[model samples]
Target: MTNIYNEINALEGAFRKTAEFETLKEAVEVVKADEEALNVFKNFRKIQIELQKKQLAGEDLLEDELVYAQKAAQLAQQNEKISAMLEAEMKVSKVIEEVNRILLKPIQTLYEDIQ
Candidate 1:
């Protein structure tokens, strides 16, 4: 069996150079420049992760945590820097998702043939 590690590395470098990734990087810098916005965003992410983990574990979410998440979402919506960063992040995620779909097409077809 052959490994495509080098090709994967090359694709990683290429992905970084893509326009989507570049825009995401710029958005990240904008967020980094605003300390308060960055901190708020970080807190929101932490809360989001914690909530998701709880949900996946079938644990009930605390009322305080729910309120905090709501407040965080509102604050992020009002913050231009954070909104831009989130939009850029979504764009990058979409690009990566499309790339993965494309890369998996051949494997998907092989599976279909076996079925």
Candidate 2:
């Protein structure tokens, strides 16, 4: 078995001679890639928030449309009631005219007798 102290020293010497390991510039570039990936995640999160806002806006629009439809239907019903009332008023006016004609016979006879 290899002596532990000798192996440790030999590994240290080999690391000192190796320049192919991570240099300062290569390590900085790796850190920049990590930072850029983090920014991409942040931007994606912002897009998700914007999408949620748009969905809420769409829901509000649909609600407003429903409200308007309900108002329009109510107005239509009110107009129908008004129309029915007008028709009843015209019928009453016709009845009144007929009653006047029927009652005019005795009134004219009295007026002629007085004259």
Candidate 3:
């Protein structure tokens, strides 16, 4: 049988070696150096987590919450450091999401076959 743990470890190593990871690290450092940007980024993440929880629980998301997030995003975009950080974060997130989808393909195929 294939060693899934080893495969996952290999994936982790590959991820660490990617340019996206380096860019993300640099972006993080830039954000860390800027107090205002850091605060805005932190607040944005807090709001995002709250919204995500509500969405996950099947609760109705209010328009005000969306507007709040939008405003936070706008503010982040106005600051170059925060904007770069957000972009880097999005790139990293996309990479992880794609990797996860690829990893789950086997299970998805199995379910499809069973049904």
Candidate 4:
């Protein structure tokens, strides 16, 4: 029988070697080296986390908070390093999502025949 844990560990190693992961690493380094870009990225991430927390708590977002989040996103996008990092993050997330779908296929198939 195959060792699932060992297979997962090997998949983790392979994931780190992917081009999407490499691009994300480079983009993050570029953002870190630029003080202004790093600040913008941090602020945007902070806002994102705060908004997500509010959502998880079932609270409605205030208009001003939404506006501020939108403005922060714009600022982050205007920073070249941050924009590149965000793009790289999206690419990496897409790859992870595909991997998750593939991993879930067996479970999905098992449920498909249930009455």
TM-score of each: 0.89, 0.27, 0.78, 0.94
Q: Which portions of model 2 miss their true places by more than 4 Å?
A: 1-78, 112-115
The lDDT of each candidate is 0.92, 0.51, 0.90, 0.95
TM-score of 2: 0.27
2-68, model 1: which lDDT tens digit per residue? Answer: 5689888999999999999999999899999999999989988998999999999999998998998
Better of 1 and 3 by TM-score: 1
lDDT minimum window of 10 residues, candidate 3: 106-115
Q: Worst 10-residue stretch by lDDT in candidate 4?
A: 77-86
Q: Per-residue lDDT for 39-58 in model 4, tens only? A: 88889999999999999999
- Weakest 10 consecutive residues of candidate 1 by summed lDDT: 1-10
Error of 3 at 58 (Å): 2.9
Cα error, residue 115 of model 4, in Å, equals 5.0
For model 1, the superposed segments whose C-alpha errors exceed 4 Å read none
Candidate 3 at 39: error in angstroms?
A: 0.3
| Cα error of candidate 1 at position 19, Å | 0.9
Better of 1 and 4 by lDDT: 4
